[model samples]
Target chain A: MWGVATGPLRRRAVAQNLSTTLGCPVLLLLAQGYDRPSYVDVALVLALLGPIGTLVFARLLAEDLDEDPPRAQALTWAAAGFAAAVVLAVCVATEPGRAMVKLLVTGALLIGGNLVASRALARGMPTAEERHG
Target chain B: MDDALIAVALLLVAATATAAVATRDPVHQALVLSLLGVALALLFTVLQAPDVALSQLAVGSALTPLLLLLSVRKVWRRRQRQGRTE
Candidate 1:
């Protein structure tokens, strides 16, 4: 496994992925303690927006990251796997129903979005000069 | 137990906020600011305000940083262009 590098953009990407994934456990904790089904929406929104946020950075900071495009393949996949595992655990804990389906959808979005964002970061967006030229 | 979690979240918010301010570089400060947003969301969630946390996640985790980074990029590009013209 390649060690995670220390570039600023790379670190930013990693932090974004980890924070988004962290929401799953927080959701589970809230569900366990509180009887509120609405809290799940927090995780859902996070799963939805987290990657888009990263992509924003990837696109806007392309020039800065072009020199050291993040390449944390192992870490990104590990975080995605962790998210999938959490979603599965939550699914098993909850009775199968709309909530389970929602959880599954959120999990799919979280994993898929993070993967796409990471790939974009690794690939690096085209610089303005390159785009115009 | 819940108190401990809240305390931890509060600590995170303080630490990240302080770091965001202390960092000199706008780009790095934006990074810290995003982390601060995540911390604040966690604090709000612990305080049993998921709605607030949701909005915080939306704005803090991504949008604020995006705006900050965009501004920094624009300024840097303008400076570069000015340097070329001069």
Candidate 2:
């Protein structure tokens, strides 16, 4: 299914997925919306954090942006290892049923793949002119 | 696979996402990215997460875009100072 979609479409899907999934946390704020006049303000905080988080990540990975040999390989392997560990741990857990396990695993893979792909694309991006205007 | 709404929701998300990525101007990108956020909020509604939809609408759709536009303008100013078009 993913093979057919263009690159940016895939990336957008990833972004949307991340926002919606991570947004699960926003549910807690719903109960407090009445008492807290600033529930919306809380949501704003998370949204701002997402992009800021991305920028910080970009900064952290700046050294590897120039296509360093060893570091790039290490980063990829590290991401892969993290993904593997999460999925493996979930599979080993006794609580979730098969259906829930499947859903969890798929969600994890989607998020992991998105992060890895976005980082790669960001690194490979040409100058802002080439990327934007 | 269930309702037509889901398909339409997905398409909207796709369009907004495309806009965000395809635009060349950073200001334009910010606008498109904002649209993506709005569309994402709508998607949350389709997914039956009303709380999420509301929060996304408030934050991602509205505030984040404003901030991004402001930041983009600032970046533009800095670029003009540095004599760079991008």
Candidate 3:
């Protein structure tokens, strides 16, 4: 059997995925008006990956699993909530088409990265016996 | 801009924070943090700043919780083992 892996990388991936999904879009939308390219990149890297960075540190402090999937399910709901919020955003969005496009791309990256990272963490978590024995 | 969805999203903010604080379990608290994360994402939207909202959505709501959960799970297992060993 494969050993359960734990460390900063997976945790980083999780936080990166989470913040990217939830925070990056807002920053991206704001950055769109700016002429400087640096703003956009910084926004993307920081806001998008901030949560992942936080998670990496957090993972080091705690354990990796429990029998409950309620938390996991709640995460899914949060994702849906984010999507619903986006829809609300679009409904209220000002005309010009550019913001919409930016919003869509940002949403895709955040949600996509998040899904991939979560799966990786799930697969990598080690059992208790593996940890102690 | 059905106002209702916006209101719902606004309402979620309190829910998320409450969830985060209401738990004794670190894992559950982490999960609730994600809800707060989504609420933060929604706040970005309402503020007309989708860029911030997008990043928050990607990282805060999704990744943070999972990582925290992963860590919390590990800690939980460790505690359980200690309990068993004792």
**Clash pairs of candidate 2?**
A132-B24, A133-B24
In model 3, where do residues sit more than 4 Å from their true spots? Answer: A1-47, A50-63, A66-108, A125-133, B1-6, B48-86
CA lDDT, every model vs. true structure = 0.75, 0.47, 0.51
DockQ list for all candidates: 0.41, 0.05, 0.07
Candidate 3 local lDDT, B1-86, one digit each (tens): 44765676677676656655655666445544654665676565565565776677567644666666667668877999999999
TM-scores of chain B, in order: 0.95, 0.77, 0.70
Which of 1 and 2 is ahead in lDDT?
A: 1
In terms of docking quality, how is candidate 1 classified? Answer: acceptable
Best by lDDT: 1
How do the residues A1-133 of candidate 3 rate in per-residue lDDT, one tens digit apiece? 0000122333323433454455555444444433332334434454345445444533443333222211244664486467547634642554447655544554555565555546544544456678775
Evaluate model 1: give its TM-score: 0.88
User: Candidate 1: lDDT of B74?
Assistant: 88
Looking at model 2, residue A80 earns an lDDT score of 47
Interface RMSD of each: 4.1, 11.1, 9.1
The TM-scores of all predictions, comma-separated, are 0.88, 0.37, 0.44
lDDT, ranked from best to worst:
1, 3, 2
What tens digits encode model 1's per-residue C-alpha lDDT throughout A54-121? 78777877767778877778877888888888788888888988998888888899889888888888
What lDDT is reached at residue B42 by model 2? Answer: 54
> For candidate 2, lDDT tens digit of each residue in B1-86?
33676688799788767766666755445435645665676566556666776666656644565576567657766988889654
